[model samples]
Target: MKQTVQLAGLSCQNCVKHTTAAFSKLEGVESVTIDLDQQLAQVTTDTAYQVQDYQEVLGPLPYKVESVL
Candidate 1:
């Protein structure tokens, strides 16, 4: 499955990579694409995961998940 999530506090392209890597480490996640310019993240995964899982993956970074669709 694929999910598009609204993101906040993504200030640079490097941040995109950081976020992508975090999500990529998850068991179910196959891929992660974060567009800093668009303030969005496209995540592809096969297993069910919760939003809190993402928050934990991101650590204490100043980011907010505005939505998931």
Candidate 2:
């Protein structure tokens, strides 16, 4: 499965790295690609996951999820 997550408070490569690391650790996530320009995270997963699930994963960060596209 694949998901594109729209996020807020992401403005640098460091943010991308952090987001990538976090998503990569998810049980079914296969990969994560973050586009800093658009503040979008493209995620590839092998198992079922929800938009809110992704949001919850990022809750502890200094960022917030705008929506999942």
Candidate 3:
């Protein structure tokens, strides 16, 4: 499955890198692409995962998952 996650607090390439790394670490996530300009992430996963699950993984970070679709 593929998910497009709207994010907040993303301002630079470093933020993109961190967000990519965070999502990429998820067990079922196959890949992560972060767009700093849009402040969003495109995540591809092999298993079913919910918005809350994504949010939880980013809980420790400064960034927040605004929405997921």
| Maximum-TM-score candidate | 3
TM-score of 3: 0.88
Q: Any idea how many clashes model 3 has?
A: 0
Ranking by lDDT: 3, 1, 2
Question: What does the lDDT come to for candidate 2?
Answer: 0.82
Q: Which ten residues in a row have the lowest lDDT in candidate 2?
A: 47-56
For each candidate, the alpha-carbon lDDT, in order, equals: 0.82, 0.82, 0.85
Candidate 1: residue pairs that collide = none
User: Any idea what lDDT model 1 has?
Assistant: 0.82
Model 1, span 1-69: residue lDDT tens:
998878889998778878888879888888888888899989999976667777788887778777777
Which of the two candidates, 1 or 3, achieves a greater TM-score against the reference?
A: 3
Candidates' TM-scores? 0.85, 0.85, 0.88
Better of 2 and 3 by lDDT: 3
Model 3 residue runs over 4 Å out of place are none
Q: Model 3, range 1-69, lDDT digits (tens) per residue?
A: 888998999888888887788888899899998888898788999876677887788768898888888
